[model samples]
Target: MYSPNFYSFVDRAKSDENGFIEFHNAYVSSKMTNSDLYFVLNRYGLDEEQKDFHIKISPSKTIQPKDKQVGELLEQRLSFEKNIPKAITLNDNIKPNIKVNAIEYIPQEYNHNSFNSPSEHHLIESITLQAHYVLKDSHKKNIQGDEQSLLKESIQRHKHKTKWGYIVFDRDEDIEQTLKQLNKTQPLIYSKRFKELENIKGEIVNIPFKEEWENKQIRFFAYLWRANRDVGWNYEYTIEKLRMELNHLTESAYAIFAKEFIRIPQLREEYQKTIKQISNEILAIVDEEKDKSKKFELAKQYSKEAYLLRNQVLNDIRDKSSEFARALAKSEKPILPSFESLIARKMQQNNFMGKFENLSLEQKTKVYRDIIDSSKNTRKSVNNKMIYYKVFGRTFAIATIAYVSYDIYYSDDRLKTAREHTNIIGFGLLGSSVGMAMAVDTCDINPICYAGFALLGSLVGSSVGNLINNATDTILKKYGYE
Candidate 1:
């Protein structure tokens, strides 16, 4: 379970004239303190320099009244966390007691080490911030006041404002109950979550993001949120949707980066490793799953992911090989990387697939089988190519010899005595070479069959060549040369 660095939610933040940061009702990750959060924010390009930040959240203030009784009841029922609106704020100044240090952000797990350039780094940071903030809002409990009428009023107002969307519950029973309470047409969904379901309390949140963000962006963040939390998402239903989105994003990112910037070697290696690790994890799950349909779907998903990863890796290798060649050419003591060396580097990529020793016997067997099959296919391809090359070379050589022999034998009457014999031998050799090439491709690997075909072709060619030579000699003799 490789987890990426989780980001804290800064609902709103601003900078003061004195060059200090103000964080308002922000949610920090459990592992990170305020000082640590500050450092991370700066590192990710979201800091005091940005001047102001805002993320739209739920329970529109205008919809709720200022009734003191309702407010008091809400405060009593909800704790400090539940009472506060989804709004976030930052204080103008850091607390005097809290010491801020310049600490580096080291990821606890490898999520995406491919982001090496400043621009790529910024993109990942932005994605993390967006996903976390949106998720925070989606998980918050809807503020149902003490009175039933107030709750009805709020629901009515919200319902009129936005389209009704599906709700996802953490437990299976919860899903069934919710589905019965609402429309049966609403689908149940599930996905692999990092956290345990028993430890954390789950709430029914309204369609959190669709109303606020663009459809494409909404779906993107939705996938991210579903992936991290321990909830059942209908994998079969969303497999195509999610897989296509991933492909689109991966290809789009690769295209933009390849065109706009030079790749960093370390980043490319990490990216390649990350994809492999993810694919291996998926394969492990597929092996564990007993349900046939789910297993098949998972297999398909894995294949698609692996295919894309392979293509990206091959493209990277090709570009790097060209680059390495160019760089070596420019150097005073230049030496090009060999084909074997390139292949060794490729094989080294599997090192990043994480621990494979822990796999069950069945999984290990399956993996080894796949490797063997792949090797066999590669060998077959190489053998076929070599066969073609050899056949072409032999045919070319034999044809050249036959043509040259005929030209020389006919160029002067001095060799006319042996012209017929030479022609027969040369044509027989050419025919035999062609026959051998044809037999190799069409026949079973039998030496006797090849020899029989070669002999038959040689006999036919000799007869034709001898006839032509004799006819020419007769004509020349009649013309008085003989």
Candidate 2:
């Protein structure tokens, strides 16, 4: 129901300067008047006090000569007047003083704010101007005997011209009509206007009148007006077209985000449920296994399944996280860096050994430290090997103790004191310890470290026995007690 600044054509007036008469309204005169004496009036006299002027000029009372005698006399007089054409001057400087009698005409009641109301009826005002002139020839004579010159006699003349009209209505109605008309006339106006706006890059020029509007509607009214003034009414239609296009684009973006971006949370929930189910199944398998070695194998299988599932989830999140972030970025929210790049930078820090060109030196250092800390609690090869050896040694000790106890309790005394018995007991304990130590040190000095430690205890026992026998033989030989 809002209205824009309305414009209407008011009264137009003319003024004579030298011999020429100029017609113009008050607004045009104010803008164009410099050296010329211009009659000022509003094109739409909405601001002025409306007045009615009554000025009527009648034709001269002179009869044309029809007889030969009268025509011959008139020709002689016209010949004489033509010879002295410069002798008389026709002065058109007489300003027509128009006196508007307010009593004769009552002013119409006009509502300046009528467009603000919700009523459908609006007023239309119009004004018209007419001029009457008198022209004369110099060949006529009076009743007494005075010569009637063209400059002295008067005859009626009529010449008139009209200016373009103006129309005013509610801003919305005006815009609607303007759009409809422009569409009917030419559709390219919209595209042309948009193209022009696009061409205006860099710093924006502020339009003062547009800022005066309270809302977008009024602002659009001002915008349309300015555009109309600049590029003509042809471009006013572009505003509506542009607005429609903007709405469509916004809806499309929203639809895409709704269908794709909003599904991520649901997908993540489903994935979490799947992961939990897989983890439970794996734990069940580990729990059901009875054999120790088989239990270890089942745990390994669970670990592999868990790792694969986790990796799949991570990859899914990493890839879709970027797509979701992109969708959000394109929405009403502000722009930011991509999630994929952020994750990539995080992973690079963990796995990269060489210099990462993409990362800053400071970032690389921070990430490297973070990765080390995250993996700090993981077991090393030496710790794993030590654990394995301890468990294996305990099992072997139990077996050996059972065997030795049975032999000592049930076997004969001769068997119990046998050298093989002592060697077997000693070598078993020594060999188990050395074997465990060798397994722990197998990574130290390549092949020699592994071989040396693996045979150290067995070699020591054999060498000692040989030395003892050699000494005994040497002493026997020296005493000749072979």
What's the TM-score of every candidate structure?
Answer: 0.21, 0.19
Local distance difference test values of all predictions, in order: 0.36, 0.33
**Stretches of candidate 2 exceeding 4 Å from the true structure:** 1-365, 379-391, 414-482
Candidate with maximal lDDT: 1
Lowest lDDT 10-mer window, candidate 1?
A: 126-135
lDDT of 2: 0.33
* Candidate 1 local lDDT, 1-482, one digit each (tens): 00012333345444468545443333323342222222222322222222222111122212122332232212111112331222223321211111111111222223443422231221121111111112123223553455445433333222111111123333223443544444344322332212122222112222212222222211111221222212223212222232223212221112112211222333334444555555566567767878755655565455445545544543444344222222321242234334334333333444424345564444443443243222212224433444544444334433444554566666765477356555675566555545655675554445456556666666766677688888888998999988
Kindly report the root-mean-square deviation of model 1 from the true structure over all alpha carbons. 28.9
Error of 2 at 129 (Å): 99
Instruction: Provide the lDDT at 385 for model 1.
Output: 44
Report, for all candidates in order, the number of backbone clashes. Answer: 16, 9
